[model samples]
Target: MSQRYPHPSEPAPEPDSALLGVLAAVIVALIGGVVYGVVGGTFHVEISWAAVALGFFTGYVSGKAGGANPVLQAAAAVFSIGGVYLGELVIAALITSQDLNIALTEVFLSHSGLVGETWDLLFRDKFTVLFFALGAAGAVAGVRKGGAR
Candidate 1:
């Protein structure tokens, strides 16, 4: 297998030639989602999901944007985190009722098994599954030397 951690200057071998340049971004997003799951723990699915979504969007945008611009990718990443955390904070802050505040935290903490509770359903798990599938598809296509048709 090729060595992981290629040098900073060496351009990477394409993961999937069809998409051309989205491979690395997808990989990074998968990493971010997995990290979100690990750090979010089962109890804090929202936080974790938020993190994963942020990462996924960032990666997806980076891939489509072209030009290998790290700064744009980084900006996308920041927006993702902001989407999750700041979004939560804003919602919580908007709850003027003391009882509603407590209920919100409780409901959030309890969300997982329920259909729409944990962000993992939408964010972490879904994104991870998606990227893994995409990566595998890319790798297979790459192995066949199908870069951008």
Candidate 2:
């Protein structure tokens, strides 16, 4: 028998560890969230397709990494939700600073109790909650789809 190389059309190899999946999922979700926030804020829009796409990307990366288990899928969804929240908060700070004619640092970093204030601001808008839920649901669905693939 002779040894043979992998066919040119063969799919690429997958990572062997669940840890890789988790890490990739986290990185992807965070980056996606930041992008979503910047674009959303720049356009002065909320609750758009980008948010759902980020969620889906997060879960897909998680599942693609290691054939993610259910626990991993759930964790990815939670992370995706958090990522979206962080992104929204960042954009909110930018928009608020712009409106007040202040630097972003003044709005986000100059206050003594800024964290609590930001949290309050985040919760003040009911739509934030809806966006989070939507992202989370999309993440779960993406994970399921990734597993199927």
lDDT per residue as tens, model 1, 14-65: 3332233344445444555444444443343345335545455545544453
The local distance difference test score of each candidate is 0.41, 0.74
- Cα-based TM-score, every candidate: 0.31, 0.76
Stretches of candidate 2 off by over 4 Å are: 1-16, 111-123
Per-prediction backbone clash count: 2, 0
Q: After superposition, how far is residue 25 of candidate 1 from its true place, in Å?
A: 13
Question: What's model 2's TM-score?
Answer: 0.76
Worst 10 residues of 2 by lDDT: 111-120
